[model samples]
Target: MKAPPFEYHRPSSLDEALGLLAELDEAKILAGGQSLLPLMSLRLGRPEHVVDIGDLGILDSLVVEPDGSVRVGALVTHRQVETSAEVAAHAPLLHAAAPMIGHRPIRTRGTVCGSIAHADPAAEMPAVALACNAAITAVSSRAAREIAAADFFEGYLQTVIEPDEIVTRVQFGPWPRHRRGAVVEQSRRSGDYAIIGLACWLDIEDNTITDAALSFFGVSDTPIRVAEAEDVLRGQAPTQSTFSAAGRTAAGVLRPTSDIHASANYRRHLAAVLTERGLAKATAESGETR
Candidate 1:
């Protein structure tokens, strides 16, 4: 299916893009267009105008700040994040999750900020952002503001982005040393959207968990940071029993919905199994578990 007829504007500058968005209330910003085009083709999204931000060179940059955080422009593709040395060194969790997004072609054309803005509950980046405590920068005609990952996602396919705002960059803090893990579920096909997924990071000291972040996707209205599970794991020496208990806690706390891909019960089971496996993998990777 082809997209509906719409006026297209290619803005060369960020200011120009902002002005266009401000002027056209029904305009949608086009970044990678991987998600937007699909929706448009299906007639799910009909905008009066399409504002293309592809030519804004500043939004295409990837910079590592002095504070060890990696700043990813909204236009950066999944492939870029997957292969970035700075991202790999500082935030391997993002690198690990990037390749799971989709096939090479889709990743090549999909933008990181676009995925977050689309807010697919099942996608990898949103969970990664939540787990890493990333910050998102949004710009509008009036002023710019930074939103933390926790507050950015409001519900399934919904976000805090106002109609006239554009997400410009995503800033991710360095992964805590001594912990990293990622897991996903798909049916016998690589690049398929996950039926369920999990990612975890742990900071360990003296054989005890110091800090931890655990995120889940494909089983909730939005990517969820399992705070109760994290709380159970923190300050505990990682043992088989502790891991098992934490997994159960996470499974019980999740509120999943039945869908075409999976039932709520099945997703809850996956959440438990994945949590145990992910935590174990993270602990081992961190060398916290012998």
Candidate 2:
């Protein structure tokens, strides 16, 4: 298969990219070209113009902020992120989730922003972003603004970003000293897309859970975050009973669809099972037992 005929532009700067986006109709931004190029080659995405920002210096940063926030730019590849000491130290959950993405070759060229922009329900990055309460930075010729991760993803492959808007970076913060995080994903084979995945974190103090965050992907239209599950664990001792209860709560909120990989009921079951396993990892990492 071959991509449909389209004009290609490589912009030198963010402003130049924005101008091109604003002027071109049905133009698509090309980052690492991991996902987009495949869709294009399959004729699933036939844009009138292709704006490549891969050479833009402004969008290639990967820095750890003084305030404990990790800022990942749109042009930063997943391989770069996978080997980043700053990201590994400050955002271990993200680091763990990075390898779960496709394969080494795909990771070598897939940008983190591209994955987030794709907003696949089965993607690991979006779940990690939501769990971390990350802030997404988007820019356009008209304005620039930050959108909270919780609010950025609208549904499967959908976000609030306008056609002319480009996602610049995602910022996540306050990496706690006592942070215990884990990313769990189950797929048919290694590097395959997850059938169900979990990104979870817990902060423990004085032998009790001070805070907890749990997010699920591949089991719903969008990532699933059950506040009730977190509520059940907060201020409570980390125990199997509590984890079980939270898992059940999580399953109750899910409305997964049946697919060839797995049935809806099986997905629901995995949601509960994975939640327990994730909670166990969280508790153990936080210096507790269950």
Candidate 3:
């Protein structure tokens, strides 16, 4: 299917792009076009104006800040995140989740900020952002603000971003060398959206779990951070039984909806399985025997 006819403006600068977004009614920002183009092609989204920010070099940076936090620009592709040594060392969870987004070709054209802005419940990037406590930067002609990950996503394919605002970057808090993270998911195929996905990490000291993050995707309207499960792991030794209990707790608290790809019960079961597996993997990566 062909996309509906729309006025396309290729803005050369961020200020020009912001002006276009603020001036046009029913305008859509196009960075990588991996998400918006598909919707437009399917006629699911029929914006009157398409503000293309592809040439805005200011939004194409991927920088590790002085404080060690990694800032991913709106135009930073998934492939760039996957291959970035700074991202791998500073934000291991983002690096680990990047390769799981889709196939290589898709990653090459898909932007990290675009995925987070899309707010798909089945997407991995949002869940990773949630687990890492990322701050999404939204810029408008009037002002700029940072939206916390917890407050950014509103519902399925929905976000708190105003129509005139563009998500310019996402800053993931630092994950030190001692902290370990992992991403695990169940999908129909290698590149398909996850049926149920888990992005988890552990902060361990002296072979005991000091803290843990359990963020689940494809289980609710938004990516959920299961505090109850994290509570179960805190202060406990990183052992099989502890992870299993946390897994059960996560499954018990979640209310996954039934879908054609997976039943509610099956999703719950996968959530439990992936939580356990992901925690164990992260613990092992941290070199904790207990």
Q: Which of the numbered candidates is closest to the native, going by highest TM-score?
A: 3
Q: Is candidate 2 or candidate 3 better by lDDT?
A: 3
What tens-digit string does per-residue lDDT give for candidate 3 at 233-258?
A: 99998899999999999999999999
**Per-residue lDDT over 8-64 for candidate 1, one digit per residue giving the tens place of the 0 to 100 score:** 999889999999998896998899998899999999999999999999999998888
Clashes of 3: 0
Question: lDDT for each of the candidates?
Answer: 0.86, 0.88, 0.92
Model 3 scores a TM of: 0.97
What's the distance in Å from true for residue 228, model 3? Answer: 0.6
lDDT for 47 in candidate 2 is 94
Candidate 3 — worst ten consecutive residues by lDDT sum?
A: 281-290
Among residues 3 or more apart in sequence or in different chains, the pairs in candidate 3 whose N, CA or C atoms overlap within 3 Å are none
lDDT of 1 at 99: 91
Best by lDDT: 3
* Model 2 agreement with the true structure over 1-290: per-residue lDDT tens digits: 89899999999989999999999899999999988999999999999999999889988999988887899999998899899877888878888789999999999999998999889899999999999989999999999999999998898799999999999999888678877888898899999999999999888778788899999999887877889889988988878888888889888878889999999989888988998999888667643211
- The runs of at least 3 residues in candidate 1 whose Cα sits more than 4 Å from the true structure, single-residue gaps closed, are 186-188, 286-290
